[model samples]
Target chain A: MTLKGILLSASMIALAGAASAETRIGMITTLSGGGASLGIDVRDGFLLALEQAGRDDIEIIVEDDEQAPDVAVQLADRMIQAEDVDIMTGIIWSNLAMAVVPSVTAQGVFYLSPNAGPSQLAGRGCNQNYFNVAWQNDNLHEAAGAYANSAGYTNSFILAPNYPAGQDALAGYKRFYEGGLAGELYTQLGQTDYAAEIAQIRASGADSVFFFLPGGMGISFLRQYADSGLDIPVIGPAFSFDQNILQAVGADALGVVNTSQWSPDLDNAANTAFVAAFREAYGRIPSLYASQGFDTANLILSALAVADPSDEPDAFREALRAADFASTRGDFAFGPNHHPIQDIYVREVVQEGDIFTNRIIGTALEDRGDAYAAECQM
Target chain B: MSAILIVEQVLNGLQFGVMLFLMAAGLTLIFGVMGLINLAHGSLYMVGAFVAATVAGLTGSFLLALAAAMAAAAMAGAVIEMTVIRRLYHTDHLDQVLATFALILIFSEGTRAIFGSFPLYLDAPALLSGPVTLPLGIEYPRYRLALIAAGLLVALGLWLLIAKTRIGIQIRAGKNDREMIAALGVDIRTLYTFVFALGAALAGLAGALVGAIQSVQVGMGEPVLILAFVVIVIGGIGSIKGAFVGALIVGLTDTLGGIFLPEFFKLFMEPASATQIGASLSSMAIYLLMAAVLIWRPTGLYGVRA
Candidate 1:
């Protein structure tokens, strides 16, 4: 075709496409480097949910953030200016979320968090355009704290990486723990060696150890802790005991209690189907991150079915607030801060045949909202 | 802290220093002889750990894994030296840095492509898995003790090889006057390749030993690589002795600072603020030490004054 004819046809096609009201979603997530697995799982789970829903009017654009907050911010800008997405989601880290969410939401774009749920977003900084399908940052740690109280531990030693999420972890544990702290230490983030920390734990005379080291830091700490021959019981959030990390940790992670809002074996139709479908699709057990991603996608789809996101903003926001979706975590609902107010269960890591996974032992917290909800104006 | 705890912490510092020396030793040696700055040294370390983990998974033998780690890393180093690095030897530091930085990306993505993003499992030998009580009634992991011994042994071997062997003579000669030695009929290229491979093997050994204790994941070497750079800087670049002393000082400062800084601050400040300040300061302790060393001795502790 001639140049002018081609240009005319392209503009016509663009106009035709715009008439259908397709919801454009921009996903900026960690896809390479150290934290790639989490982002990959989240993307896979999100894609799986979208596939299951079979939504034809939704368009998604994915970009790698490289686990860097600056890169995430840049991608958010590009997505907003260049792609003009109506919604944003799929940031795996709290710091990255903190960097991108406020600006995106302030610009009148809806952001549905898949994994990261920073306290700032759930507190006074909460935005009407922002929704977190996952529990607040402190939810699982608070559940672990409650479980620690019931386990009858009078004294406990706690540790976490020296970062915002780590501070939140320690504070969350302290909120409901009701135990005397024998020690409270913050190690360097991404620190591989825990000898100094382990020595302190051994010398602290604490009854048990509660730590919030996540990802490879958790694996290293557990292996080194085991080798140090400290027999003290350990408790943590599910990021450490998740299916992906558990295999790397091997038998050492077995029988360790962890808390989370969802599990592969939660004994619900939604969860059972999610697990089966996820395994068939990805050929591995889905992690809590994957579940959150799945839930986030389904939440979007549910809202999309009732109203166009870019056209009727108020109605779409209400539809999202209603959360009319079958969550893998049964009976999921949003709190005042637009974060989940849901039951957090305690799970013990166990081996089934060859694969290592978590099994729900008991409920730790029932229908728990976040501590920061009171601070949220929205 | 109790006497036993202090002793244990000291041992931990020594072990950590020894491990850093393995990484620094090769780095210093390579810089000394080749005058090439290789940022991809860390990639070699990661390659070592990955190879070790793969070998261990297949054989279930820790010894075999270590051997394989050294072999694989040395091979990688030689290949890198010949293909990409050989051309950069005559270039400026910026060009070398850019080229090697590109290599880091390539190796990281390549490893990720081969082994998925998940961390690999590599455990210490069963015999060395538990803690052992020292003479001072301090219980420490036997594997760490082994690590210290192995590091010292390697240090000794390096010292002997450099001080007593013909290749060591050529290496020393090359560092001083490469053109002179080359004109004297020593194949400078072969010597450079050999020195690089040897350094790579040491780094590999360190990676394998440390990987058993830590998670064997992609980009695991970068943090240690930064510390290794600090070590070589403090030890004086291109000086193995300097690297050794610098490594020990860094390790001790880091370990002891982490444990005692908070306590020191708690004596005056409130507990919470003290903990925060102490943690922050402790993380900066090594860098402070490096600064102090640099201020006192611009040439580094053992660095030869140019």
Candidate 2:
């Protein structure tokens, strides 16, 4: 072997030998670029959970993915090969999760996803080593569809960016909404202008509109929609009306209905504590993404307490599947696909004094698992 | 679609077109006069938006925020031209591209550092917040209509400044033969600085105007920058008239193609697959247009003959 290879092996042996029971956790999340806010919240929430648990045996290494799939793959490789991490988590985007999760799981490392539960991973690609703390990608959209039906909407206009998640969003909505679609338009991903789409919506004579444009695209759409003078009631996944986004959207998003598995105002003992602690720590309201990260960390800690990852791999997997920890989303449980089966609630955007945040109005889908779970052989 | 819907979509196309023209005009001017391919032009646009958002937040005045945006971007452009871009003028295109690309990273990080990751809030002025009825009984956003008018006004002003003023003569002479202008005792360096700053101001104006309707966030300018480059390329490099025409073409093709292509395909194909194919094709429509333009008249529709 070359001297470099020999030295690396020596260090690996030393690291392995030195920490008999220490677990290394690798976190790959978007901490820069357009999606940085989500990552920051996730990281902060994860760190907050660990700090509260006081788990010094768990060594967590965080790296910025820069919202790119390729960067996430590289970080996963480096963490697995060099750091010899026993657990991996903290991928926020579905595309990046798809890029990294399968390979990491195949390599015998446990991956606990804090966010991004793409349907592929929840179905045919399901692995024993993978667990998702967040709801499946289509869960909120499905809830939106259910809520729309209950609200007695007969005609709805739906739109989303043309991508995998966008397709999932529309399909999820269509699965439950029995109403006839007034229009369905798939604009280019990252498209900021929605004037043409809005014009079509104005002309379509729809009773309601549903969209799934996340991040800045959502902000742009909401602003333009407000300016368009079209008064059709609008609904979407909570991604568009999240705390961080609502601040950017200003007053335009007020009174909009959105569906989510968790909200800052979700009334529960765990959620109340999480919101308080998160505000104390970050000086901002926690988003659903943050709650997901917190729950992911708590689940890991719960599993670690029950069985060791390196020594009792099967037991650790079973422990994760059991999901014994108290979730910010109360009554969380894993479905057959290891994705969360939880109540998805409908929320309304409201201004509490100065800050814009969501208030839970009603449960759209209670104990809702994913449609793809039956496809998973596992 | 009804005729009224078509009219509204066309108006939307014109609004988007004018915004693209604002960005492309500045980019074309800098390239035309200085022959500098500045990728950092987008960063300047971002700076303008962020500055506008901050000013509007603090002062609660949209017009003042717009003025601040222009001043900040122009000052930034002048400084960058003097300090960093000035040296690269004598270098090759590769070096210029590399340096300006690095500027994009620096500016993006710097803006993020100051503004944080969350997008800042900016909205249209109260006077232009809602829609207005047009002659054809079509309702459109007053803010977008104002954008089209402002863009056309700027285009007219730019045309007048270039065609009538003495400084315009110097700029034209510099584009043709810089050494000749320098020999004629023109302060060519100052002229270059002024031109860069002027280009920067236009981009800033576009950013502030568009920022009212769009999210004012980091890395917001890069996408528009790509479209602006496509516009300058299709309009012909170093041609102002080409940039304007090219921007309108791109904007209309994109907006109309997005709305119409799927409907056209649904006549013969299943609606689901038709939409999938149509959406995919419309995203590529601009690139295909650029390719067609290049093939027909290499150097662009209005590119000066080599």
Candidate 3:
């Protein structure tokens, strides 16, 4: 054989390998109707981070869920079967996340969560292929519970909708709080009125009230809470007090306390730059969900840098576990169970001129894991 | 539960009932008068909310936005009735249901196309912003109280319009015998248009009022519409008084059951199991109540025999 022929054949083989080695990630998140604002923010944040990194070898297949669990499952299945996604990520609700994660991971594909780490996954059910770039389901609420305990509230009433997430939230609160619970009320999921619960709380004579009502339920509860004229402090997790509810509740949410792992006002170079870029691009303040999504994309990008693009699943999973990437929350590390161990802060809703925003008042805990971590074999 | 709490819950239930009545009243009127089951009624509610939010954003006046919402919903109702609903009057129930379901899809997609799929919000006016003290040291939201009062006033107004006025008599006559009324030279088509418009206006008002307390967005009205259907079915198919009563019972049972069921279960079961079972049962309480009511009174409380 001639040397010229050998060199031409080698070049042809290299070109074919490069084309097949392209890495692809599938993103499924709520992106239409009521949940669209949050979904759009997450999508934009992820894409922006990807663009800034300037890596064309990685491709993303983003699908809108419309906040339906069944649709989320279908989209995840499609991404795996048809698109042949190497990794799956981005789900906003714990219920939807729970539904999709089992299937994605069962197929031996890596599933990374930008948001929604349900307590079950953080505890006994933790899996090696699943990683949460966001905090555990209970971490933020545990912070709120810790804050409430510190405030000397001996008897507190609690309310949440009756769902797995809701039950987990109450359990999360009880994990940190060592006090007498005056009453615990679980209402129907998506309930619109709080009058009966308000009456019960008033009668219970609790020192304070802690709630875990997210989405539209949060708006309704906050409005009714204000209407009931209860002077007791109202505390909740960040999901109920974020920008989505802030816009609906407005002045009514003023002085309400909440706990979160990430806030727009966090002091860090990455976060400051992120907030500015997000506001410039979207014309709105980015929520923690957006920040987490941005971080997840960066995490995957960093892992891609370590693993050979042609490396198989096991190699990619190891690279992801290392997770050496810049995050808006600053210096975050994943626990053995693949959930983030991060700082949680207590924030109060305050009016900044005409706009309402959360202001950090105290740090409840730093680098915490779920209480059920002891039970997790992983 | 203490007396005060029970009273408060009842009031809450009544408030919820009244809101359902507003929705159910329109639904029942349309069904009784036209023999049509319009599933797109919820879309009209969403339209009212969207319109109110947009106008309020532009004008910065809640009252004017509310007025505009009513007018816009009425116009929308009239247009839908003339163009789409008129074609379905002679059709069967299944076809009517399917067409209105299609209208829901069209309305939702069209709304998203115009509003860009994000939720729009409406703020409560300053006057009704704070909590007001009611009799017996019960502090309640002024806006909610206002809603209850408005609902009662609407109920009275509807009664007077349907019972005392000439249009009311014509409507009653029309409902009793549409062909006979048509034979008597009544413009049945115009009367049908007016009835549909009136129903739409009520639904619009409910949407605008509720939007202040919840996020206004596409598909927002669907859940409430389902409850309204349950209300009318339990109250009686064609009876307004039945709708009112059924709304109250359903609302109170749902709210109170959610709160008390877990506690009740805790008496016999472990806390965790009780919570799981209780939550599930609370969601089903109203449906169970409706079933029991049906077993006893199949035609509903105020339903007249056909």
User: DockQ of candidates 1 onward, in order?
Assistant: 0.61, 0.58, 0.57
Candidate 2, residue B166: CA error in Å?
0.4
The sequence of per-residue lDDT tens digits that candidate 1 reaches over residues B95-115 is: 999999999999999998899
Please provide, for model 1 over A40-109, each residue's C-alpha lDDT reduced to its tens digit, 9 standing for 90 to 100. Answer: 8888788788878766566677778887889999989987876778999999888889899999999999
Backbone clashes in model 1, listed as residue pairs: B235-B242
- Give the chain B TM-score for each candidate: 0.98, 0.98, 0.95
- lDDT to native, each model: 0.88, 0.88, 0.82
Q: Which stretches of candidate 2 lie over 4 Å from their true place?
A: A1-21
Q: Higher DockQ: candidate 1 or 2?
A: 1
lDDT of 3 by residue, A224-260 (tens): 7876788878888988898778977788789888999
What ranges in model 1 sit over 4 Å off?
A1-21
Task: Flag the better candidate by DockQ, 1 or 3.
Answer: 1
Which digits, one per residue and each the tens of the lDDT, describe model 2 over residues B1-306? 788888888888888888899889889988989999999999989989999999999999999999999999999999999999999989998999999999999999999898887777687899999989888778899999999899899999988988899998988898889999999999999999999999899888889999898878788899999999999999998888999999999989988887788889999999988987887888899999999999999999999956
lDDT per residue (tens digit) for residues A51-111 in model 2: 8886657777788888888999998998898888899999988888999999999999999
